[model samples]
Target: MSEKPISKGKRSVVITGASRGIGRALAHLHAAHGFDVLAVARNFKDFPHHPNITCLPLDLTWSDAIPKIIGCLNATARPFERLINNAGIQVELDLTRDVGDETPALIDREIALNLTLPIHLSHAMVPLMARPGGTIVNVTSLTSRQPKSSAPVYSATKAGLASFTSALRHQLAPLGIRVVEAVPPLVDTDMTLGRGSGKLSAEAMAQAIYDGIAAQRRIIAPGLSRPVLLLNRLLPELVAKILAKS
Candidate 1:
């Protein structure tokens, strides 16, 4: 479903996983900053309303998801200036565990949602993006640099996305479309609850992402992720060990 946008003159941003957490914060932040926001999520029944925010309730893993999104944008006839691929899922499981009954489905869902959907969505959205200065922001994780033992699949997906973001950046340069990797630290979102300490708020991360885009930063490693990435470079083993325990 799509909500009618309140205004048309403002620059537009399309954000996935926008019903809650960082995605929700991003939707509100961009709308507040005078951008018409297309907020995509599976459900928006609980999402806060905003005149500039148009809600698109969609299951990203569906085969027809990309087409539906394209249709929604086509209805607008306006190119989006930014696209943020932030929808993801993390299903923690031990690969060595004897839970075949659930392992395969869980792994497949995690991989599909965390990696495949974003890749496909980004490719599909490129044509709809504003040329000469469009930005595509892929939200990554610190776990990409140092895998979390309990969330192996999630970590792997983030790492794969990071690599894709870098390669896409070079490929899109001629088109004047910038691809960015936003590596946020452990955030105080539902996904990270009961998992980490000193978590950054979703609002803070949302602001940082906006600032990074404005500054044309290809890699935005905000909060603790900045120092952790530096430390990881100097002491990879140490960083890995620490993350393995998280």
Candidate 2:
């Protein structure tokens, strides 16, 4: 669906998964900077109330909800300066194990949230984005660079998003929209509770993303993700062996 032209006024940002973790941090950062924020999440009972923030409670997994989201944005008449696609889910079940009844449903949900939603939202917002300074940030993961054994579907979805972001970047460059890929390592969010060590805090990761966007970095790899990416590039086999052991 095409969004109507937004009126020129206060810069606005739309962030998915804004109820917690990195998404919450990004919403606060933008709001603090005086930008109006459209924070989309399933629940906002604990979200900080802010004058510049509008909470939109919605489930992103429902493909039919995309049009309603865009319609809401159009009705707001706020010029879009940024769109952060940060909502995602990971099922940590090993595919080789005894399959459960819910495995297929979980896989579909993961793919929809991690990959399809972002692509659809971006497509809908491209025409409404600010011509000269708009930005779209896709929050990918280190797993995209090197897949994990337990969450193969999550890893594949992230890798697909990375590629989509790359292509979208080139396609949108002529119109001056910046497409940014944010690759973060294990983060200390509820999503990764008790999963990995040496994880970066959500606040720290958000700061890195903000700084990287300000600097117009095409790819933002914060904390351990940076070294992990470099190692994967320089010594593929060594990285593969290490990941295999993990």
Candidate 3:
């Protein structure tokens, strides 16, 4: 039998960190897929005035502004059936910066963006999205599966997100909302600029997220992320050691 097609109708999605990189790519891709989107970023200047998209610029690390932004969107008209937590920044590249020096800031920032923001935002949108056929895709990292010594904090943040996604899926599955983890390998984006030995194209990662949403796949790992997940499952210690050396 042929599979049922994805029910498309102005996908009605909310994607964070939409100014550039994977987040920006996702916004464009979703629009191309006929989604009416609310794209949030650090500032509106980085976003374009697309007919299908509404740009909401605010630093999510603050955490206090999320409800207000959601309220604004709701006041205008709720056009979000899916919430893509795709916004993130990398502070670990400056790894040698040291703990007492700036590690606290890095740790705090990662938790805010990678963990707290998404969790709070998800909670806010649950009633709106957890009804039926609703979806959520969290943009995670290959480092979650393969711990890189160079980016210790980034890996921790991704790992936390991975765990959160699974737990969220379990909690919201019965409610009909699909919480998915879009695990991406290294991508050629500003965040990964000048970093990551080999890079997966942003388009590739975007397609993976789209496919995951279409299929309601709980975990979508593209390119090296897939292999990394496998190794993490089969030989975690070996993978950890290998990653440390890389």
Best by lDDT: 1
User: Could you report the Cα RMSD, in angstroms, for every candidate shown?
Assistant: 1.5, 3.4, 5.8
Task: lDDT for model 2, please.
Answer: 0.87
Looking at model 3, the pairs that clash are 12-81
What is candidate 1's lDDT per residue for 176-206, written digit by digit as tens?
A: 9999999998899999889768889999999
Cα TM-score per model: 0.95, 0.93, 0.88
Query: Which candidate leads the pack in TM-score?
Result: 1
Tens-digit lDDT track for model 3 on 16-75?
A: 988888888888899787877777777766465566777776788885668866775566
Which lDDT tens digits does candidate 2 get at residues 138-207?
A: 9998788888778899999999999999999999999999999999888999999988788888889888
Superior candidate under lDDT, 1 versus 3? 1
Where model 3 places Cα greater than 4 Å from the true spot, the runs are 1-9, 93-102
lDDT of the structure predicted as candidate 1: 0.88
For model 3, state the Cα shift of residue 236 in Å. 1.4
lDDT of 3: 0.78
Error of 3 at 153 (Å): 2.4
